[model samples]
Target chain A: MTTYKRMVLASRPQGHVVPENFRLEEVPVPDLKDGELLVRNHYLSLDPYMRMRMEDVKSYAAPQAIGETMIGGTVGEVVASKNPKFAVGDKVQGMFGWSEMGVSDGSLLRRLDTTHIPLSAYLGSVGMPGMTAWYGLTQIIQPKEGETIVVSAASGAVGSVVGQLAKLRGCRAVGIAGGKEKCDYVVNELGFDACIDYKAGNLKEELAKATPNGIDGVFENVGGEIFDACLERMNPFGRIALCGMIAGYDGDPSPIRNARFFLTMRLSMRGFIVSEHMDLWPQGLKELGTLVATGKLKFRESVAQGLEAAPEAFIGMLKGRNFGKQLVKLI
Target chain B: MTTYKRMVLASRPQGHVVPENFRLEEVPVPDLKDGELLVRNHYLSLDPYMRMRMEDVKSYAAPQAIGETMIGGTVGEVVASKNPKFAVGDKVQGMFGWSEMGVSDGSLLRRLDTTHIPLSAYLGSVGMPGMTAWYGLTQIIQPKEGETIVVSAASGAVGSVVGQLAKLRGCRAVGIAGGKEKCDYVVNELGFDACIDYKAGNLKEELAKATPNGIDGVFENVGGEIFDACLERMNPFGRIALCGMIAGYDGDPSPIRNARFFLTMRLSMRGFIVSEHMDLWPQGLKELGTLVATGKLKFRESVAQGLEAAPEAFIGMLKGRNFGKQLVKLI
Candidate 1:
């Protein structure tokens, strides 16, 4: 209880991330000070955005400082508390990095009621990922009834919710995933109208077939050739909510070959970070929580055991190895 | 005067357009029917958008059919009239294609007043090109008072007005053009804050120096390495009004290499054709007309002498040979 394990960014990745990029160390958990609470982290969220922060470049936020705790979202319970506002047994969500325990001042911590939703759901469906999907779909894409929407990385945390929300709005939802397994799960379990397996090597043809009426809205997560394929079939005046480009996490961005479509189709594309739009988080979270609690929106997770496995999990997630929302489970 | 000269699409260009792609033909003028009027074309607009319609590809509009008079905008005088709405010697604007004379049913004809504004200005500053610049700058880029806006092809019809309009809105306007002459015109004549000569072989560095604050808004007319250079220095939440990609007129679009910036900077990019938004035209044209009429907006023209010179002028315009609004004066 006095000591816990955590991972720190040892070095920035050259091209692709490797195990050596992260260093795991056992450290003493700090004692809670006045107006402070100690959180024993349960699960850490591994997202593509962290890779962006790892780079020593100008981005939306400052780069993740080298040799510092790797930034992440964690869902856990308060083990010790001195603040009157927080109880010791209360479950909470905070950006506590990739660590087994963290000390916070309750300023950034959100108390979680895990009666209907599970604690891990805070890191996936009802947390930042869910809010990202909701904001992009509702605000950017704005799909109308009977319109067709294409969701890239359909099995990932953010994209899973985007398709579900699009379907809820009475739009035809199509998903683009990596393999046959993920594609089947997207269509059969997640209720997408159609799913294109990008790894099948016929992405352009399959995507065109899936989107016969052309894509009205796109919730793009994995940008590369996959995105180019989507752009080729985009309907006139289509809206693209560019959430992530996991394909470019290695510092080199994939070129958009179908740039002509942007002009010819008169498309509107906007890239956004969910944290920047906090005003809509409450509304988005409420809807996402309801769907997850009612079993209407199903989400799958791939959890790697212990803090030491985070680096590999994150690297694998970037390469499309992870089946769903990648998380590090710290017990 | 019974027979008038017109240019028609002879063949589709493979990669680059040549004079052989167009054929000049002399045809007898048709007698006007009831409610129809005859227009003696004075000026024909030659624009980059015409190059797009030359290819038989899927675009916002249909391809320019072979052996048909090439699509264009013209300002002319009503030579004869059967419609009560028109009269002899009345100056008018219409989509009369690349012809010395045209017959209109008065449906598409717009009466023009040459009191303060010249007839030729209707095809440049107060015409489709001007409206295009207005829509992209005001509706899409939406530059703030202190924001920095960059215009490409800065001496061309659309770009010349884009910079001038941006300046009128109190924005810092930067321009990118091919030669010293166009660059000088963009800065000294058009009132852009700075102009980068892309042909100088140091576009990236020159653009960086010109836009020290980074680009907040981009009025993109030429999409190639120049557009890529602008994307590199775009500020956070930058907006790009993708108006044209003249570099891609040969059918191959240039790829966007800095696609990662789209996400990291949280930018908004929209590709638009001005003609599609008919609702905003009247308001936009009124403002543009006032600017030109009051001498607040100034323009330049690269005029070809006659209808037979259009094909070569258009080819030259595509290669950045035209200094300003390229037009063919068929008197």
Candidate 2:
């Protein structure tokens, strides 16, 4: 009998999640039914939004139930299949959770085309995180040519793509990251116009120096003081696309101090979820796929070893310890 | 020489303005130059936005310079004229400041026709304040038919027009006012769907009772606690047109505590100034004028005696002591 390992939510966390909160268990692989397929997960995706789902609070999505498998995106091979659509040895990607194997009826899974792009690009730039960047930039910010855009969490999965896309659209892209290392990577490697190291002192002064023309668009991720400082620097008719506030996920939500600028400068601030706009996914995927395959768009990843490392990797991601898209490579 | 009484800014107030902050002075009306017309002021418009001008801070308009005549809208008749566009004894309206008589170049003045719509209504419902209501409602909220809209400071000039216009658009109008009397007038006289007395206590409960289906649109004038309470009751994808924030204009700006809901609910909030959108004014004025001329839009006034009473009336209006549009009758 084939056996597999999977991680389940042991309990809800109080402040920061601990390893004890997730229980790694072994289970026998069930036989595939007439229309079902058994796939071995090769990789697992970890993101900041998963931190919100860990808590039983009012969020855009429902909380993760206890004893249930920790849900996430995965790319793997169809080792056994009785389904007509997915054949044995076919590669597929979907939300298959933190497990060694996933049984599917081939509904949510997408067949992979590994000829141009790697199998892992689907989880970072050409997948959910990539689509998120696309929706926020195209639908909300929609910065015009020569306009300036400031994106927080600049070296991360979603923000990296946002900066690259803005540059491609003929706009000046400024990024805000944690350290000198990440900042350097963002500016030198990612080809962003400028990258402000937020961890260093005098954030407001640094931002002012970088954006002399005033910020016309903001893609906010880290909420607290960073969001407030960026808001004060916005020009008239500035547009803000609210994405993530990972700074507050483990603690009290950040209090936006300078929202009064909304009136004085006549700003437009909107918050959105990528899942809510499913119609834009196909278009986003097509563009993201082409860019990644053509070597025009670039991405980086910090991968952990196995399913047992997902809890620690996820916790580290919230703290911004991981450099880029935090993924777990499983076999 | 013709002399007139005018209210000038004596000094900037520390917290709230008193009558001492304004000085009533008699100045000899200057001679009308070429293309100039001398106007004998009949009515002066008092609005909340004028308070923003009183402070020497960064705002949409320049600060009211001490010892200068306080800026405001006025409606009057041309007693003497040299310009062919304006004739003697012709009624006119423009920015004539807080003066009983004004000398104009006939450049800014518009001839009034009180045959169908009352001239005072031009200062209240079919004028600048009315255009503010139009631009915010149409451009930001853009509520669908049968959507619920909550208007704060509902009995005042701008807000009264907001509710009346919303009702005309086949929307459910909900008003929030200070006292029972103003609330009664808002519901009984103005034909609003419901009115909440914010002063009666149980504000949360009252707002909950009023907006059972959840607030789809909010026309926010009075920010602070009232705005916080309203934001909590808003439905997903709610749109807020941020106008005046009178509640916090005196001391400190209100801190938005529930701004995180912006992301959870996917809300779109935008702030606007009417003068900035001049292109929409003609369209807005035509519709507003028709509404008032046909008696479809109703308005009420709390007229103060003369230019000397302007400061006291304005202070009273800020304290919610006025029933409707607070005006200073200069004739």
Candidate 3:
């Protein structure tokens, strides 16, 4: 048996999750049974949704229990395989948790072919985050050409893909990011029509200038004040795809008192977990892969080295320290 | 030309409209121009929408002017017709205002055929109010069979029709009205599954009792604490067809805060003006007429005797004194 380091949730957080909430421990490597494979973690994805799992409250996904390894999606290499589908040295991506090594019964893991794209891209641009953006924009919001589309957290994983896809569809894409650097990346790098720095005092005015005719579609990633600002400038028959509410995840839930605003605009706002749309994931990946290969899509990763840094990377992502898709290189 | 007494908006109301806000004036009857008809008013429809027209502020419809005759829909008889489409003694329904007689260009009037149904039924059951309920339920909310639907202002014109339609579709309909009498009318006379009297204490608990499965569809007419109660009991993917916010209309401009509740439930709340759906009125009227004639739909009218009593009926409706659809008879 081999030993590996794993980060486990030490306690449920009340407000913001700190390092103390997680404990890094050296644990015995789990034994692989028949039909199971052993995977050595290569990269770990840190997502805003992890914050929800850290809470003990009921949500779309099950909460991580105290003293259990924190749940996460990871790109790993199969070092030992008793399963015929996955051979030794075969790369895969799955909910393998925040660990250096793990034993899986081949339930959640999908065999990743590195010949088509880099294995790390399987956890970033061509993975769940990319699929989330595609399904939300195409299925839920269904934005039309020349329509003004707004995405909160625009420089982040899902929002970045959403903005780029909106632009590719001939729609005017406006992004709301935290700082000038991320804003510039979204507008200049991603070719978005406009990027508003939400941290700036003039969110309402900036949004007005960005979308003169009013926003027709919104991919809501960060809710709260941004949501409030977006509501004021939405056009009649606008659609809102509520992918996440990261702004209120870590903080105390702020009361949203804007139902009348939504009513008057006749907006259709819907929230959905990405897992609910898994059937369309292959189609999403195929399109996104083509875009990435053709240089029509761009992606960035804020990679933290080693598995021990997963906690800090997660905390930093929640605090808006990461520029794009936050990941931890565990090799 | 004959002289007729008309009610004019002498002043805008700060809150609920009072008799002092309206001025009674005798104006010379307008002569019928080419393509026009002189209509002698019979029954004036006293609707909640009239209150919206009284405000100087912009809304879905243009506000009534300070000295202009008060706007309303009326069932009338054609006394003189310069228009070929209409002739003397023909009964009709039109935007005839709160007056004994008026000349219409035949553009705003629809000839009422009493052979199919009663003339006043054109103003209530198969008219704008009926169509509003039909569209709100079928197009906006679209409740499936066995779904629990709740409607506020349940015994009022729009709500009464909405509850009956829901019942026809095999859905459980719960209503909120003013008193035990109106509540009884909603359940027994109109055939709602259950009815809650807002005058009764513990609104939230009462709503919970009425809607044990939670509200799948909510036809919102009154929007204050009742709306708050409905929000608390909304099921996932609930839909709200917002026809009016009568509760807040007379009291405050501040909208009710139900955004967070809506987001969590992933609710679709939409506000629509019935005027936009005029093209579908024929189909709606035909279907509703069949329902009423076949005894599947029932409607009640609280008719005031004269034009002078219209103000009192309207005020009573606003104060939750009217049992059902309120109307004024001038003939």
User: Could you give me the TM-score of model 3 versus the true structure?
Assistant: 0.90
Against the true structure, what is model 3's DockQ? 0.36
Across B1-331, the per-residue lDDT of candidate 2 in tens digits comes to: 4788999999998898788889999999888788888988899999888888888976667899999999999999988888888988898898989999888887788899999988788898888889989989988999889999999999988889999989989999999999899899999999999999999988889999998888999999988888888888888899999997888677576777777778777888998999899999889999999998888888899999988789999999888898788899987
DockQ of each: 0.89, 0.65, 0.36
Q: Please give the C-alpha DockQ score of model 1.
A: 0.89
Per residue, candidate 2 scores C-alpha lDDT tens digits across A1-331 of: 3899999999988888778889999999998899999999989999877777888866678898999999899999999999999888898998889898999998999999989989888899999999999999999999999999999999999999999999999989999999999999999999999999999988999999989999999998888899989988988899999888877777566777776778888989898999899999999999999999999999999999988888899888988999988899997
lDDT of 3 at B282: 85
What pairs collide in candidate 2? Answer: none
TM-score, B chain alone, candidates in order = 0.99, 0.98, 0.97
Clashing pairs in 3: none
- Candidate achieving the largest DockQ: 1
**Which residue pairs in candidate 1 have backbone atoms (N, alpha carbon, C) closer than 3 angstroms, thus clashing?**
none
Candidate 3 lDDT by residue in tens digits, B147-177: 9999998998899999999999999999999
Quote the TM-score that chain A achieves in each candidate. Answer: 0.99, 0.98, 0.97
What 10-residue stretch in candidate 2 chain A is worst by lDDT?
Answer: A251-260
Candidate 3 CAPRI assessment class = acceptable
DockQ of 2: 0.65
